[model samples]
Target: MRFLSGREAVLKHIFETDDEAPLTPVAVTVTVTREGRTTAATSGTAIRNGDVYTFAAGSLPLGVYTVRWDGGTAAVDTSWFEVVGGHLFTVAEVRAYDADLSADRFPTSAVVRLRDYIAGEFESITGRSFVTRCRRIPVELDGSCSPLPLVDVQATTFEDSAGQTVYAVSVEPVGPFTLAEGEGSYTAELTYGFRSVPDDVKRAALLRIRTLLFAERSGIPDRATSFQPAEGGTYTLATPGVRGSETGIPDVDAVLGRYGFDVLDDLAGVLL
Candidate 1:
């Protein structure tokens, strides 16, 4: 997408007035796809640009990706851009993600989350049948320092206001996040997604989730944590009473229905 200078913001620690902030995302992850299949995507850091919220591409897959940030208002702009192998990303098309929607109906993370939580609660509460595509992908860190290289969907790709590159990782998928719920009768496409990453990139994303579970801090941001380094193709997260490695990441069932959808929230919990 051809993002106007004011249409998006660089993925960095944006300093803005609280009331001026778009929305505080507890956790977010990058999700993308190409050629009707999944790609190697990545994400990093949270950022905001005035009223415009933009997420730059990270060290994700090589191909054309329709990128957009998905944590703020549905009124937030989403544009389409193309990624090449030996060149920087190019914008092919530019338009608002939800420009046509009524101002009153623009979707936000909270609005989406509340709807999903209610649907799930409704199903569980009254057995009305809840439809969702949430699943956990276990992970293993390998072939890197105890610390994983950074990967991201757009954070790294977007140059900061200072015009310096952020070393976070990135991801590009074969497609976008999906939803098949009958109530809404609508699905979200993978225009583009964003995520925060550490310095280690060799670690497969699945293992990244396990790192969040067994390590310290939180996974929503996927911030770095203290862990014991292991030999060859693996990293470890351990403590006095507990220790673990990428070899055996566990999968926890869907505990909450965020946004009546699973793609972003599920992965968000796993990565953060």
Candidate 2:
């Protein structure tokens, strides 16, 4: 399940015994963790409502959080939830992209789902996340120190293999820089990714969603690789078959190509 940031995160759990009977424990407690760090561990009992135990986790920051419930009688359970800022595109933006789209015909929920689906597809193609979040990445020191495999990194901190804070490390905007002293492996806590989706990326998503909506409404195949016209010309789509990166739409692919690995490598001057 997912919740928006700064919203009350009410977690619920139901405990059952071997015979599928609702078993109310003597005491219940909740613990929350994010990015391997414990943010909240409550000793207070969770509110019980019949067989369901609910814990008010309060407003949490943006990230995937893990919740553990200890029922004190070995009735422990774990669950996870994510808190996000918002979707990549808004329904209004979608409607603005295509003036023909009307809420009465398309519906807001459907547009939201399509936007989310396209955002996921965009990430899958680029192997890059657009949401701003903290990530712990393992880095190896090899004297020459290659750039980290990320972009738009905001800030970073380093810790050695033993998890002790390492002060001898430096960084370039997107990756870990040369270490002044130690070698081997280290963990870099990077606060990276774009705070807002780029305009080009949003356009790409909008274009893909338009194609999907068209196919769904008109009953035409989504992606047509090849089509022959009666006028006698055989046309082939310029879909890059490398790991399913291309979307088979020329305009969408054009926008994505600007952010592809090849372009990133060209800008960084280092093959990644």
Candidate 3:
């Protein structure tokens, strides 16, 4: 069964008789567990439909869930499934972003890849996600860290290696602060990420996606490509243009430059 993260999973079970016929009016027990916690447990009867007895779950939460089925006697069955999130942008949106382009410019499959690639880059560079989901997130820091690297932090725990609690002294939704000035980790349990994509970022992503796709189709290297001359093996020739900048596309770098900080400097605190 296909499961989407942050969504429900519907499971269906079918049973047959010794003669390979439908087992009608069979009673079965179903249980679902996650992280060693029982989330769902139910007993029901699967009335024969056409040629087979079919039992199914109402729905299960997103995660690796253990599904158990017992049909009395010695017949027991267990299985596993996983849930993952979908693309950040749709194929249609990619096309709409560049109306001058044709339908065949970027195929549905290519669009899927590009959307994910762009979203990942956004988070990696900005330290923030365009998609919004209410879930737990862990924030990390290094020594003498002045600015917090993440944003939209609702709550967090500052702890040391011994699991000792370290007071923040000051905390904010987006922060760059001190955590006892020692080795520790922060496990944040709160709603984070962007619920909506900013117009500028969206535009910049589309422009970059288009630029890369066309360059790939033409067998030409985009701005990120690097060259190493045989004569100068020790020295590498880096691409002159910037990633979002110098792409011959206006406002791409302009938007990225502004959001880059939003990803990096969300938190501002004086180091003590």
Computed on alpha carbons, the lDDT of every model, listed in order, comes to 0.30, 0.69, 0.53
Ranking by lDDT: 2, 3, 1
**Distance (Å) between predicted and true CA of 202, model 3?**
1.1
TM-score of each: 0.21, 0.64, 0.48
Cα-lDDT of candidate 1: 0.30
lDDT of 3 by residue, 1-272 (tens): 33445554556666545687555335666666552344454345544455344555445443346667676773667766543344355567777777744566556656655666677676676666665533333455454433443454434445444445667524543232223233346643333455567777777787878876786675434543555556865433234254444334555656655655542233322332
What does the lDDT come to for candidate 3?
A: 0.53
* TM-score-superior candidate, 1 or 3: 3
Model 3, residue 222: distance off in Å is: 5.2
**TM-score of predicted model 3?**
0.48
Q: How close is each model in CA RMSD to the real structure?
A: 21.8, 6.0, 10.3
Q: How many residue pairs clash in model 1?
A: 56
In model 1, the worst 10-residue window by lDDT is: 86-95
- Tens-place lDDT per residue, model 1, 135-213, is 1121232322111121112211322334343333233332222211111111111222222211121122223232432
The TM-score that candidate 1 achieves is 0.21
Could you say which candidate leads in lDDT?
2
